[model samples]
Target: MAAVVIRDPLAFAAIYDRYVALVYSASLRVLADVHEAEDVTQDVFVRLWRRPETFIAERGRFLSWLMSVARNRSVDELRSRGRRHRREALNGDTSDDDPATLVPADTDDPVLAAQLHEAQKLVRAALVGLPADQRRALELAYFGGFTQQEISAALHEPLGTVKTRIRLGMQKLRRALENRV
Candidate 1:
């Protein structure tokens, strides 16, 4: 499929369909923001499509390569925004803590599938526990990639209020996950 990707866009699209979710999830987990995650996902695929020749099967599996690229790019993004984040809040500096590390492609292990299912449920429950305003702000900031000012404008709230909501929301999330983490 990759060999034909340059000549056939459909092949590239198929690859996108196969890995987009995984890539996006990894990006989101690392960046913790929807907009940056999406950008990273798009950038990863674009790099693959634009430089198919750079990939050598002899070096490694295609999927692994894609994931490595995604991880590196995401970490780079995080590093670039160092001042914006509380560095200690992240799991670790290594890719070992990456959410994508928990996912393996083309697996048939029932136990692994169950674990993934349970993790999803836990995340959903955590989201549900958040206050409505905090949750909305978190969602908008994390998933929508909106700045604090932008979020305030969109929600028609004061800038300070929006910032407070996001802060309180993050603290709540950390407290909720403190034990498990």
Candidate 2:
């Protein structure tokens, strides 16, 4: 069935219909957002439709491969959203934004301000590219001013998972920036 999907695009619909619920459920479990889950579900099927040969029978079951794609894509969406917020904040778009509240711009030195702005944008993009769990944990702990315990309760995730997400997320962010330099 998986092999046939590559040859015939219509057959892909059957595969999507069979696993859409399970895939969307896994996405919602990770993301906790209905709309994001739906987007992730659509993304997962799109990836399959575009590259059906990516799934080889010798590798494993199609369902398992599809599940991995769904989870990873949901996390990607989470990170992307975070980056967008970071960009908005840096641009001084807060509802109650004041000059002092902005991300430390140097109006007197346009070159320096531009450099800082570009660096911040790079960081924002990296932050948003992180895994969804890590991005959420970092946002809550750093920007949201929430304690780890509070985040765990609010997200209804295991305390250890929250801790691990933050730790891993930070490490990945650091590595991502370092590689660029």
Candidate 3:
């Protein structure tokens, strides 16, 4: 499908239709703002359309790569604004937390929905199992889109220490999700 998308840019519509919900959900989970999430979703698709080769078939599944892009873009939006707590403090906004709710009701495929829920559980579990310092560093880097220097500055830790924590955290996460991912 990536090959098809690359060969025919117009064919991207099909891919986008299939995965936009997941991408938007990934962004919304991080941004917690519908407008910002929509912007990130559009940016992710545009970048893919312009640079289809970025999706290397040999590296991993397209869905995984696309989700990473969506997440990173959402984090980038957060970093750009320099706001750690931008989400609204509304009392009844639990929609973003449920994987099933993230998928549109019209396109609700139980298998894919279940897979998303399972993946979220697996990742949350892996993150929870890490040491506090490692988990914080990884969350800041991956979820907050902060660079090592930025993390060091924000956390008041040495840059080297921040880097080491992120590296160790990633290694552990990779090991934990090796078979499942």
Q: 6-101, model 3: which lDDT tens digit per residue? A: 467557776787788888876776677788889999999988888888888899888889888898788778767764363232122235475655
Q: By TM-score, rank the candidates, best first.
A: 3, 1, 2
Residue pairs in collision within model 1: 34-142
Candidate models: Cα lDDT each:
0.72, 0.67, 0.75
Residue-level lDDT tens digits of model 1 in 98-117 = 45545553343455446546
TM-score of each: 0.50, 0.45, 0.71
Q: Give the alpha carbon lDDT tens digit for every residue of 37-108 in model 2.
A: 788898888878877777787998776687777766765665567644333322221224234423345543
Against the true structure, candidate 3 has what lDDT?
Answer: 0.75
Tell me the alpha-carbon RMSD of every candidate: 12.1, 19.5, 4.5
Model 2, residue 96: C-alpha shift (Å):
35
Q: Model 2 scores what on Cα lDDT? A: 0.67
| 10 residues in a row with least lDDT, candidate 3 | 86-95
